[model samples]
Target: MISISDDVKVVENFVRVAQIIANLESILTQAKNLSLTAKNARVVALRAGDAALGFKPITNFIDEFSEQTIASTTKIADLSNQLFKVAHKLVRCSQYFHQMTLLKTHINSKQADAMYQEALKSQRRAASQLSLALSELENHFEDIQKQMQSAEYIAVTSRVEATNAGDFSDSLQSVSDFIASAAKTIKTAVVYNLSEIHTLRGVLK
Candidate 1:
């Protein structure tokens, strides 16, 4: 015997939670970008010798900020998962209520029809919200992929600059290769997530 108000409240809460998760996902994407940029800068500074001595402290600060960002994102992900579970429970409760009403002989046809329509509308709205959340996550993944590619380019340019100056070293070459490989891996992951999100969206539609 859940009230309409209770059902509306549950939906509202789920929307709010989804929005929070979207925002946190955006922040995490930016953090990873910043981390990649910092790592590239460190590689550049190591090659530039005494001229780039002042960049070490800046690079260290960026690393610390990136680490903090990762930690915050982890917390957000945990909270989002818990909120999702609650939303699923609420949806099940709504379904049960509908079934109970259907079994009642006293309910008129018009009343039953109205209730069924309302339930269908609510379900559609929930699906829309979930789709939007998945889209946001996909965007975040794409942004990360772009950033990783940019980082790889920076790393390569730095290596070439160092080699031109007769400062080529095995460590610099290793760093360049690592950044390129990491970028490729991130791109693969993003593609997989995008496919998953696309499938979910299609099913919902």
Candidate 2:
């Protein structure tokens, strides 16, 4: 039987997983917003004609950044889902193993012994799987951080280009501000999710 304390630990781990998922969702939302802002900036650049020529290329970079961020978040989301499933399996395996251990003390049958061994093996396998999932999640988190850095660079460049857009400087500056804000939002979410993943790792341990 799973003890009350064990049940509570499992619930806490689940909550951590939920928080990670929520943070990923926030990233996706902000990425979409960045994409829209990029499109609007492109329109403004076109209106400014030759005066905003440099800003036009910067808008393209913003669009690319948005696309890459969305793609990265999608991969992270899928990995996190996999991590969640593996964590659930680990919990079940632990519970079953615990039960078999309790049974071993009361029963002396060879079949019970065999079943107990099998449960132990399952628990080990689940633990290994969880480890692999956590490693993959860490990789994805690192990838996102790298992407955010590149996005930050693009945002900085956008601001520089915006100032050179002559009459369109105000409009372009607004778009640059949006890009910077979205980049910050996405980076914050990634950091938050990374911390949550670490908490989940601790809970599993």
Candidate 3:
């Protein structure tokens, strides 16, 4: 029989997975907002003619940054989903092994022994898969943090360019502020998710 402790562990794994997915969804929304702000900045720059020429190219970079962030977040979300599935399977296999252990005391010895061995094999396989998936997810989180740094750098550059936009300075500056805010939100979400993943990894170990 699966013990109460085993059930608690399974529930903890599922909770962690859900939290990470929710954080990722928040980051994705911020990234889309950043993209929209970039387009608005581009339009403002165009209206400013020669005065905002430098800022126009920066808008393109901002758009690219947002797109890249969106793509990376999507990948991470997929990995997180896969990790949840593997974790669930691992829990189920462990519970099965526990059940078989209990059965060994009441059933035919030979059959129980055979079933016990099979359960052991399945549990080991699930453990191996979960380990690999956690490693991959950790790597993806690191990649996301690096990307956020790049996005933040671009946001700073956009602010500088906005200052030189002549009469359109206010509009461009507003957009730059929005971009920076979005980048910060995305970075915060990523960092939070990464920390949670680290805790989960340590727990698994």
Candidate 4:
């Protein structure tokens, strides 16, 4: 039942996964910059005396969240690379299987059908394993959602505390806003990747 069109579809899915992998590198770089910005914000808050006492926890939590963001993003990037490799390999396997079918169609020999069927079975097995890797990627991205939820909490807290922190309130607010914006980037990318993984899995099926 496999056709050239189906094979092309599968290859396209693999390319999308590779694209997502590429996107993660940029996200990580943004996270690193946000982390440094937060560190500087903490120092500014500390100099503001008792008026900025509430900012201590807010800035501390942001600092910690940024660290976790970098760690988890790196892990996700690694997973993406593995997923891309598997998906790309499956594309080649599918293409070869297609070529074998064209030969079988022309020869019209009983032996050719048998050979094609055997190769088809092997292709399906490889496809299943590759699909499982995609599932793992979705699960890993779910973990990132949890991480972003934590970051969201810290961002909200930072905003509220900065409001009452006096002369540096504007500066602190800007820091909180930037951190929240960075968290939004993480959230958007994770959602997009999960969607692509689902589509890629369907392509394999």
Q: List clash counts for every candidate, in order.
A: 0, 0, 0, 0
What does each candidate score in C-alpha RMSD? Answer: 8.2, 1.5, 2.1, 2.9
All candidates: TM-score: 0.57, 0.93, 0.89, 0.84
At residue 43, give the lDDT of candidate 2.
Answer: 98
Descending-TM-score candidate ranking: 2, 3, 4, 1
Report residue 48 deviation for candidate 2 (angstroms). Answer: 1.2
Candidate 2 residue 62 Cα shift, in angstroms, is 1.0
Q: What local lDDT score does residue 176 receive in model 4, on the 0 to 100 scale?
A: 83
Tens-digit lDDT track for model 4 on 28-86?
A: 87678777987888888888878788988777777776777778778888878877777
Q: Show model 1 residue runs off by greater than 4 Å.
A: 1-108, 164-168
Q: What lDDT tens digits, residue by residue, belong to model 1 across residues 113-170?
A: 6766766667666666665565555555565556655656655664564444334345
Candidate 2, residues 57-104: lDDT per residue as tens digits? 878887887888788889988988988898999999988998999888
lDDT of each: 0.58, 0.86, 0.84, 0.79
Residue-level lDDT tens digits of model 3 in 80-196: 999889888988988898899889867868889999999989999988998888788778777767777877787788778888888999899888777778878877887888787
TM-score of 4: 0.84
User: Which regions in candidate 4 have their CA more than 4 angstroms from the true location?
Assistant: 1-7, 99-114
In model 2, the worst 10-residue window by lDDT is: 196-205
After superposition, candidate 2 runs with Cα above 4 Å error = none
TM-score for candidate 3, residues paired by index:
0.89
Q: Lowest summed-lDDT stretch of 10 residues in model 3?
A: 196-205
User: Candidate 2, after superposition: displacement of residue 125 in Å?
Assistant: 1.4
Superposed by TM-score, candidate 4 places the C-alpha of residue 136 at a distance from the truth, in angstroms, of 1.9
